[model samples]
Every structure is written in C-alpha cells, then in structure tokens.
Target: MAAKPVILQNKACTATYTTRGGALVDFRLQPGGINPLQFRHREKSKGSKEVFFNGHFVCLGNWGDPSAGEATRGHVKHGDFNRLQWLSSQKERQALLSAYSTLEGLYMERNVALDENAAVLQVTETVQNLHTVGRLYNLVQHPTIAAPFLDGETIVDCNATKGFDYAFPQFSENICKTWPCANAFDGETINLSSPDRAYSSVFSFLVNPADEWGWVTAYSPAQQTLLGYVWRRSDYPWISHWLHFEGELIRYRGLEFGTTGLHKPINEIWGKGLVSLLGESTCRFIDTGDTHHRSYLSFLHPLPKGFQGVKQVEVKDNVLVLTEKNTDHTIKISHQFKTKYAIQQ
Candidate 1:
C-alpha cells in the first residue's frame, strides 16, 4: 500500500484520517446529522477540523491546520491572554513541534483500526521523548455524539452520586463542574430527564477503580447499538462530558478524554501524582525523558429487542495498574468491555 490517508467506512459508519497531524478529521454514521460536529478557533487565523458522526459533530481541532496557533492557550482572564504565554516564542514553538512530531508519527503508525466484525473503530496514539530532554505538552480527545439519543428516548446511567459542582466564575455553572474524586464513576452522570430542571453540559463520571483504564460510551435507542470507547489511562487521566441542549449550533453530547480537567490546570493536577512534568526542569526537550501511550477503542453491539437493564462494568485489573518509577517506560494492554450499556428501544 502507498501509505495514503486511512479511511474506514462500512454500511453503518465512516471515518477519515490524515497523516499530517494523525487526526480524525471526518467521522460519520449513516443517515447523518444526528450530531453535527464543528471546530472553531479563538483566533480567526487559527485553523481547525470538524468531525461528524451520523450527521452529528463528534470532534474538532486544528488537525494539522497550519493556521491554528502553535501555542496552547490557558484559561483567559479579564479579556487578556496572559496565561497563554507558556509557549509564546520560537524556542517554545520548536519544542512543541518536536513533541507534536513524535505524536504525529505515532498517529500515522496506529491511527485507526476496525474490529473483525466491522462493528467498531479504534484510534490509538503513542508519545515518546524523541529528543535528549524531557518536554511538557497538553493532549485532549474531543468526541461529540448526538444528544437526542439520550435526551429524547435514552438515559445515561453510571455509578456516581452527587454531581461535581462548578464554582469557577468564567464558565457556565450549569455546563461545568469540579469533581473531588480523581477517577470517573465517582462523579455523577448527567440525567437529561431530571425534574429539577438542572441540566449540565460538562460533568464528570466515575470510572471503576479497576477500570481506571479510561473510556466513554454512547448507546442508540433506535439502532440498539452501543458505541464504546476504551482508552489507556497512562496518557489520559481525566474525562470530560459536554452536552448541547439549548443552542442552535448542534444537538449533541460530548465525551472528551484528556490528561487533565477541561479548561483547568491539568499539569498541576497530574504533577501531584508525578505523572506530568511539573516545572521548567522537567519540561526540557531531551530524548532521555519518558514516553507514554494512549489507546481508544470504539465498537458497537446489537441489543436484544426491549433490552433495558443497567449493569456494573468492571475495569480489567491488569489494564489499570501503573508502576511508579523515576524513569520512563511503556505500557500496553488488550482491554475489552470497558463500556457498559442500558439498551432501551
């Protein structure tokens, strides 16, 4: 094969990959528009990519769009972009470029995979310190699914209690929350049918400590298919949930996985666990630093007619355990069934 862009499609779905950034620019299910995905840039000059599934938007980002700003901006304050100075110069750009190139190469090597039955699509990426110095970087997975699947007919069920209450002033209180627990499933999943009329776009769910392996799932009421994501925890520590209910933009829900809380300081949080680079010394660009890998699996399951039951999904023990080490290493696993389901049609 000529190593062309990878494109996976079947009777039910389609996904497009680009080697430039090893990004999923296009993903869609048949009979599209259920979730219309769009990518936007804070600076108009910055470029972006919009991914759609079933006509609904799933993910969006620069995806090798050179126009997108090379620097990752932090939380804005008082209409100022001060916190974004982390990567403001040529030196920082060069460092980021080196790290990003490594990630891009991984994406090229292990970008997309389809299950044997063709019922799932898997995306994988690995990050290795290519230079002699260590580097700090930010990574996030932005996946959006249709909200009608949950709000209209289906419901979201997870093993969580009270929802994380967001106290931040900049974001919408109803959209985001601060989770006390480090793991998912401890945070409550948003119930679209709540009578309190309190609906949140951003919330956290508790993942089984055993499954500390990361993942997100979406089930369809009409199709009786469950779309699940099983990800590696070493690369992504946190997962973010987003829903678009009242906007004209698009009717959808998002399950974003990442290294830190969205719109929050992840490096600080991960640094406490010694997983993320903390200070300037740890951010040096050296090949002698550590390497990490994150994998995500997406698959579909056919639900029996009238199937409606909640089941406790457990994480694979071997998959979630992490060994503490002062040096870098590699972690790999073949994880399955990380996504639970309550099929109702």
Candidate 2:
C-alpha cells in the first residue's frame, strides 16, 4: 500500500503530508482551489523522475550536487532526507514526523501545524548528527513554484539589496548585479518576476539579512494570492533565486533559502572558504552526536483586489505584517508561528 498521509486542516486551509520522505504533498489555500505548490513533471515527460520530487522537501547536510572530491566523501544532491519513509503521528491540528537517514548520518524530527482560521502552515525540522567523526554540512528549504500560480505577471520580492550571478567554469561568466533586476544570457536586463523562454540564470542574493529575520515573497496577480516566507538570517543568510523557462512541461522557479553562500558542494564551500554565511563558513562542521535546528514560517494569503505586490514584511508581537508596494493595503497574520519555537516530536 502507498504510504498514508496525515491531514491537518482548519477553517481556512488544509495540508496533506505523505510519510514517504515526510514530504508535504499539498497545501491548499482557503476552501476549494488548487495548491500553489506544484508537483514535479506530472505532465508526460520523456525521462522519468525516479526520486519523489514534489512540493517541498528539507535538505539536510547538503543542498545541491556535491563536487567529485566531495562525492567520494559520501555527498548526495539535496541530501538524503527525501529518500526515507518517515514515521508519523498527529495530535489535534498538528502532525509530527520522524526519520533517520543513514546516508546522511543524521536523525530528523519535524512538526507541522496549521492555524485554526488562516491559510498558514508552520514547519520546524531538526536534524541531529549520528556520526562517529565530524562532517561538513548545510541545510536549505527548497520550495519550487510553478504554473497556474506562477505566471508572467507574477512578482517576486525579497529583502535582498545586492547580489551577483554564479560563474561556473562550464557556464558563462557571472557579473555583480542588484536584486530583482539582472542581466540574462541574452545580454538584456530582465526582471526576475517575468518569465522568458531564453532565460537560464541563477542569481545568488547576498542577503542583507535583517537583524533578526529575513523574508521572501511571491504575488500572483492573476490569482490574487500572495505567498510569503520568513526565517532567521543568522541560521540561513543566503538566498538563491533560480529561474528557468526552456520548455512547457519542464519549467519551474525556486525561492531557495539556506545556510550556504552558494549552491555548491562542501569541496568548494569548505576550508577554501570562498564565501561566508553571516560571518561563518558556508560549510558547517558538526561533531558527532550534535544537533542543528532552525525555524521558519510560510503563509498563503488571499489578497485584496488590485494588490500588485509587497513592499515590506516584518514580524511584530506574534503578528506578520505585509505592506503593499504602491498602496496602503497591509495584511496581518496572527498565529503561534509568528514567534519562533523549537520543534516538538
């Protein structure tokens, strides 16, 4: 039988999570509508996506592909959290899932909760090292957005001030640029919000993190809905903005936040110390039996009519306030997750 999912619902939204990989499969906003989070390649492709790549998955100990040298050290792309069937249970409006990945040498416990009357779901995941020797690691929250919700007119915003593109030896040279607007391969500066078939670029925002929090937002003008995320800048000070639009059935964008300066393997990130994440190394050094933790909040808000995009977002007194870019319209979200807390499982 397929691994069953635990359902968490409220008056405004419902979330479904599968035990396989403990992946969040669906997060529907309001009553009856499609989920903003897209599934991977359900639209008839030539090749198969063997690993379950849907919705959002926690990347523990690593994020992207590991270097050849690092691969010899037992590194896998996106870590090993998505390869295990997590054990799950629930209480009231919250669900708890736990699992241990021998490949990643870590045990993780996660807790997900939905607000009683708002389209907000909060998740907290903690990964503890189970190794006999110290290892280099990193953590990232990978949330991919796709069509029906992400369109040409959709606007992406964040607190990033200045950044540059990645200059891989195989790819083109990267240039330093500002946020939201950067030069694409076609030699024309394009807004990150707009989609282009010829655009193939990765913008790494050197996040000028807030004193306590950092944020990213996406507004679908066509859908009149806004998605927002807030997290600690100290824990994850780098944000990667990946945009691709090559084919109809294979295009998607990612608003990835993590503890690394770039989406590279520990080989490129460690001792060389090419970049620093909030005054620390991009690669983390975890001793045996030690634990690492972080917390974040994601909300799907039904916006007022004519809402173009967001100007500012901040947490105040257990409330999330979103200020409109060109108007006085502001959305406030009040919930337990407005304030950070440790994960309980």
lDDT of 2 by residue, 82-144 (tens): 768899999879989999978677889987888777777777778788978878888878777
lDDT of 1 at 343: 14
Q: Which residue runs of candidate 2 sit more than 4 Å off their true CA positions?
A: 41-50, 69-75, 167-174, 185-187, 195-197, 247-250, 275-280, 338-345
Where's the lowest-lDDT run of ten residues in candidate 1?
77-86
lDDT of each: 0.38, 0.72
lDDT of candidate 1 vs native? 0.38
RMSD of 2: 3.8
TM-scores for the candidates:
0.53, 0.88
